[model samples]
Target: MDTQPNIRSYVIDLADQLGIRYQATPEDALADIATRLAGDEVVIDEIEDLLVALKRTGAINGNEMVTLLGQYLDEKFSER
Candidate 1:
């Protein structure tokens, strides 16, 4: 399925706020974050972007957000 661009943009834009935290390039950062992806890891920035975006948005709390994202990515990879 084609993912949403706004979500993806939100991710990278969010990553920018993370600055040093996201030391790698956007693509690399996504790849690393998405390594939960099996066998052939994907470079899907959309997913990574979402992670960063969620963190960037002050709408949520920190520990809860991490827990939520960790569960999410695990589920996504588990599906593969």
Candidate 2:
């Protein structure tokens, strides 16, 4: 049983829960989540956990994770 599709679906579902309205792929959802997280005053644990899980599952690579985190931090700190 291939779990890739299932994992992708789960990512989309999590994105929805995070308030992303339209995401065609896991990467898209991840980017949107990162953007939203950048604007948040406090990091949401569930979303952070989801990102870690995605990384563990190979949905995102280390470089991608670093890029997203960098973007989030840049935006977040620039506001301070």
Candidate 3:
């Protein structure tokens, strides 16, 4: 599980790698989708692109990413 700060920081770092300026808050990052993704509103394509880059670079796998995100989300909502 990732803490709010961790998730926020990680996403920001990913954005940096993708050459995208993600100056949003952690909550914003949670809601924001792939910037380069197609579709009218969903940025899933962007996410896929990022995933590919991460995979190629051996940065992080999709499973690890999901686990961290899930942990973060659980911790966040648990507080509510």
Candidate 4:
């Protein structure tokens, strides 16, 4: 079973590819997601929409996008 931070590897890698600087720490990626999801509640549809947008824009591949979505859901639901 993969941990939540580990599951965000693709996103952090993508950020690195884009030359975006973030904290050199384990929680940075999760923090990034929280920052993005801040103004509103994050729901499954939003996650799906994000996945579609990322895939449509060639930002993330299919399998990994699914994995990311699953991980995101796990993190979200696990917090409840």
Candidate with the greatest lDDT versus the true structure: 4
What's model 3's lDDT at 69? 58
RMSD of 1: 8.6
Ten contiguous residues minimizing lDDT sum, candidate 3: 35-44
Would you list the rank order by lDDT, best first? Answer: 4, 2, 1, 3
lDDT of 3: 0.54
List clashing residue pairs in candidate 3. Answer: 37-46
Q: Please give the TM-score that candidate 3 achieves against the real structure.
A: 0.34
Q: Between prediction 1 and prediction 3, which has the larger TM-score?
A: 1
TM-score of each: 0.39, 0.39, 0.34, 0.44
Regions of model 1 farther than 4 Å from truth: 1-44
Every model: Cα RMSD to truth: 8.6, 14.0, 9.6, 10.2
Residue-level lDDT tens digits of model 2 in 45-74: 444455565566666788876665565555
- Residue pairs with colliding backbones in model 4 are none
> How much is the lDDT of residue 70 in candidate 3?
68
> Model 3: per-residue lDDT, tens digit, 1-80?
84457554565577576665323356545556443243346434334444445554557677866775566566556779
lDDT by residue for model 4 over 14-46, one digit each (tens)? Answer: 555755443234464576588677865443444
Quote the positional error of residue 50 for candidate 3 in Å: 8.4
